[model samples]
Target: MDSKIVQVALNGLENILRLGEQESKQNGMGINPYCALIEEAYGLDKIEFLQSHENQEIYQKAFDLIEHYFGVEDDDPSVVPQVDENQQQFVFQQQEAPMEGFQL
Candidate 1:
């Protein structure tokens, strides 16, 4: 219901997909099966497939696995970085111009 909850769920899903990609690579597979499934659904504009009732069950199970394996918590406040006002402000300086006739 809450956006934060959705974000956490999405993060969990991403973690599962990342692991799938790594496993696929280790097995000499060209494409990750998990990512391929998402791509196929996305081609039909079916992004909601992840949120569908059936998939939600799978996602919840995968999320639980991710939490158990990675020690990730959806409600961990320390997960978010706290930036102070000074840290939020960044200043960039321009580099000096290169020589006009320089050749590579």
Candidate 2:
């Protein structure tokens, strides 16, 4: 799996856990077991364990849970803003052109 994808998934899990923890604090309660397990699975040692095929399932489950909680479906191009090719070309042209009052 791509590291960027993994990082994003982990971030989602962390965000959910943090929110739950905050809510628990407000209610005068300790962190929940589900959050604790998820946090533990995201630890460095657990990440290393994910390198193995057997442990990959655990990571996948965690990612799936995070995605479900965050309401994130698979990647959708519509969700990401894209720059027009013409716009990028225009920007490049502007940068290549000499400025009126500045030396390059």
The candidate scoring highest on TM-score is: 1
Candidate 2, after superposition: displacement of residue 7 in Å?
A: 0.5
Q: What digit string (tens of lDDT, one per residue) describes model 2 on residues 13-81?
A: 567666886787788875444455655666544544544524455567555544444333568754555
Question: For model 1, how does the per-residue alpha-carbon lDDT over 38-65 read when each residue is reduced to its tens digit?
Answer: 5566621323433343445545654544
Q: What lDDT does the true structure give each of the candidates?
A: 0.56, 0.56
User: How many residue pairs collide in each prediction?
Assistant: 0, 0
Which residue pairs in model 1 clash with each other?
A: none
Prediction 2 global C-alpha lDDT: 0.56
TM-score of each predicted structure versus truth: 0.38, 0.36
